[model samples]
Target: MASDDLFLTPLNALHLELGARMVPFAGYSMPVQYAGLMAEHQHTRTAASLFDVSHMGQLRLSGPDAAAAFESLMPVDVQGLGVNKQRYGLLLNEAGGILDDLMFVNTGEDLFVIVNGACKVNDLAHMQATIGTRCTITPMPDHALLALQGPQAVEVLKRLAPGVESLVFMTGGNFAWGEVPLFVTRSGYTGEDGFEISLHKDQAEAFARALLAEPEVKPAGLGARNSLRLEAGLCLYGNDLDQTTTPVEAAINWAMQKVRRTGGERAGGFPGADFVLAQLDGRLPTERLRVGLIAKERVPVREPAELQNMDGQKVGQVTSGLLSPTLNQPIAMGYVRPEYSIEGTELFAIVRGKPVPMTVTKMPFVPTRYYRG
Candidate 1:
């Protein structure tokens, strides 16, 4: 893609001033690294790091039928979502394949949604074509997003946004930073105690500058963000998840609430409900299942790497992999045959024409520190 064809965030100039190394990501010229990926990753683990995530798609849905209308498209209990609470949801196709994964919050008068940058265009169009008549969908293109993440994130945010300390994980509320109106959610992709703030695009630079001025906060880029999330065992849309993957196969069945499952009041009302519920009930068989793998050696096994058993028979392929900055070891996520998906199952990842020993392990290579208070 041409440089001129890339979109620039409202804080583009600010990132340039901070010496951020820019690269094209999801149609936007974004900061991929600042200072160094390892240093920034460590800083976020101990203190706090601010990420410019303004490229994400933000939308508002309002209408008396909004909850019901949206519920028909996802396998979650949107009608039961209380005001100020957010839920992770999946958009599935008719065949039970995922279209996109998103976070949606009920903001009392309206529903607030945030989708992946790359899939937002198609996501919007799909929703409009399927459910637009029942609810009003308005894209919030003028909004900019920032993520302040780390163990000390709350302490840093509380200093400026008073009362935010009370918001627990998966909860959100409207607040203010002086005169700037802000909507903040106590959630993030890094599996850390953090908040994702949304504000007017014009105020993004100033807000980011203010946050960066804090002693505990530093500017981090996408490079650190990727490593952080990978260590957290979180899924990246195009990499760890895709249209060909189902929620059950992806090991994300937790996102499907009980209210939408087999015996509930509104059970099996969403798209792909029959297939998803069948899989959930064990009535359907999955060809492969996603699992975490720990490389026995220091070598990182990247995606598309073949996985094999002791007999040298191919079982699966790696989806995402990297040397974890936090764990100081190589880790990866991949899909394997049902027999090889069990934790502690031994396997090999073929990297560079060589077999790297690996073991299927429980995920979140690093412990998550989500604040529930």
Candidate 2:
């Protein structure tokens, strides 16, 4: 698509001013890199980095039946979600395939949700069509989302927004920067202690400038964000997950809260619950499972690369791969037969018609540093 036809975020001009290399992503002209990917990635791991994620869809769900009605679409314990708490969720099709992965927060009086930018349109339509009458779903198009990530994030944020130091991981609350109201969540995609703040689009540039003024914080872009998340073993929507992949197959069943599982009081209420529950009980065997692979050599293996067994038999294909900046070794995530999914199992990634040796390894190639306190 043409550049003029692409959507721009509230921080688009700021990104350009900072010399960010722009690229098309999820129908938006977004920054792919600024001050280099490797540098930004390392900075975020050590200190703090600001990422503009305003392209993501934000919505508010209200009404007395909001929680119950929302619970019908995903395998989450929304009824049990406490105020100011957030949880990961998956939107599923009737066939048990994943539609998208999202994060939702229980604000005392309503629900605040963030969905992938690419799937936002269809996701909203689906939710509205299914639960519109039961709840009020209001899209927040005038808001901009910002993710401030790293070990020093708390310290830097506390300097501007007081009382944010009290929030632990997966928790959030309404705060303010001067007169601008902010919804800040102590959570991020990079497996680090961080916060995602949503505020008026008009205040995004000024707020971002203030955050950038901090000595420990630098501007990061999507390229670094991708590598960071990959090192943290987080899933990227189109790559690691898709409409045909099930939560069980994607190895993210942990997101399915126990209360929504079989034998629980609210079991079988969401889409594809029957099939997902069967997989959980081992009554239905999963054909393939997502696992982490470590390349035996330094060569970087990328997605769509064929994964093979000892005799060159096709086992699966790589979904996401990158040379991890932190580990300085190549790592990948892909689907493979259950037998080959075990740790230490030998596998091969076919690259340039040559087989590169790989082993099934535990994920988060780099350890996650989440602050629960």
Candidate 3:
């Protein structure tokens, strides 16, 4: 893609001023790093980092049938979600494959949605096509989304927006940063106590500047964001998940509540619910499963690397991998044959035709520090 074809966010100028290295991501010119990837990654873990996620899409759904109609598109308890509560959801196809992963909040009178940057267009179209007649779908293209993440995020944000401190994980409410109208969710891609703030584009620069003015908050980019989420064992839509992968195969079946399962009150109404539910109940077989791998040797195994067993026969392939900045070791997530999904099972990653020893292990390579209370 040409540089001229790239889209800019509300914080584009601010990011340039802060010495961020901008890169093309999902049709937008986004900051990939500031200071450096490693430094930014560590800063977010220890303190707070502000990320410009405005490139992602935001939408509002209203009307009497909004919740029920929206619930029919994904396997989750959207109708039962309490006011100001949020949940992670998956967009599935007829074959039980993931279309895109998203987050939705039942904010009193309306449903607020946030979808991946790369898939926002398709996601919007899909929703409109399926539920247009049942509800009001309003796209918020003029909004800016920001994520303030880490252990000290609450401390930093609450000082500016009161009542934010009272929020627990997966809950959110309307708040303000001085005169700016803000809708904040106590959730984030990183496995940390954080908040994702949605505000109008006009005030994004001023608000982002205000947040950066805080001593606890620093500007971070997409590079650091990816590393942080990976450490938390979160899935990146295009990388670890895609149209060909199902929630059950991705090991994220937990997001599908019992209400959408085989025998619940509102069971099997969403797309691909039948196969997904069967897989959930052990009636359907999965060819492979997503698992976390820790490299025994120091070599870093990256995506597209083939996985092999003791006999050197290929069993699966690596989807995402890197040298974990926190652990100071190499960690990766990948899909493997069902029989090879056991924790502690030894495997090898083909890096440059050489076998690098690795072991399957539980995820969240670095333990998550979510604030539930």
Candidate 4:
């Protein structure tokens, strides 16, 4: 690799051997494709696919007051989250702006946390500077994160780990991959039955190879990963969410535990709690909320395109838009006026200065395939 080349994950060599097209994402040279987006996507839906997601940051939080201290910046009821279960949430700024969306999974009574790769450095710095007194945050950069997702993910997983087939979503446990310590979580971004395996960096290659040896598992890339998440109606942090977006407008109110709501016990202590609470108290109408839009034609809409009402009044702009391989249509997610957010509501998208007919539709462009078993 050249001096200016991006960093490579432990699975980089494995991905290269599989003919993956590598690209720079979040400062890491990751695969964007192996076969093709459509093929890779369908393979995952019908079978299983493995993804190298080590670029994401993993951290452990501990101390006497770990859970309480971490909740100071997040809007979720962190303390009440059960051990071995994970919850998604946002890290907000003082003004209610989102710093980043993350996941917190309780590994033990004193430890929990997982953050985004793009913001991990700053997230750690900010958390330490602000809440260091009550908790100690340790970044686990030595580990690699890999995801195996699809309808057959469980079956493929059970080939190595018994009892994995019964693991519920958003849950995790300590396991072993041929005697090597592994932390396997029954969660993924693809909205399918899967697991995100966190393991020693040195073990990534061997583990991935073992999984690929199965007839059901194929190597997937970033292109299919994006499409799969879109099909599942999940948000991409930087594209769908940013410092300017709030959890309310993003339609992620479920992430806020009831105890963290306004006037409830333990309320108004997180960052921008006043603004968030006021928004939750009917003071905010959720005027512009996240919704899916189906374009009239095959013309894929990209970000920053204007969304218009029936009367041609501009309402909002698309945050993340793309042609969904699974749905075989152009699908997009954007904030639209609440009045126009109802399913089947007709709307228009300003595409290249022209109004393209659109309709407000239910999200997860393709129905999610989460394993409820």
- Cα-based lDDT at residue 242, candidate 3: 97
TM-scores for every candidate against the unseen true structure: 0.98, 0.99, 0.98, 0.96
Q: Global lDDT of each model?
A: 0.94, 0.94, 0.93, 0.85
| Residue 42, model 1: Cα distance from true site in angstroms | 0.5
Candidate 2 residue-wise lDDT, 241-291, digit = tens? 998888999999899887888675787789988888888889999999999
Off by over 4 Å in 2: 1-3
Off by over 4 Å in 3: 1-3
Which of the predicted structures, 1 or 3, would earn the higher lDDT when compared with the native?
1
Candidate 3 clash pair list: none
Per-residue lDDT value at 20 in model 3: 91
Error of 1 at 29 (Å): 0.6
Tell me how candidate 3 scores on lDDT.
0.93
For model 3, what is the error of residue 80's alpha carbon versus the real structure, in angstroms, after optimal superposition?
A: 0.6
Q: Which stretches of candidate 1 lie over 4 Å from their true place?
A: 1-3
In candidate 2, list every pair of residues with a backbone clash.
none
Displacement of the residue 208 alpha carbon in candidate 3, Å: 0.6
Q: Give the true-structure RMSD of model 4.
A: 1.7
> What local lDDT score does residue 276 receive in model 1, on the 0 to 100 scale?
83
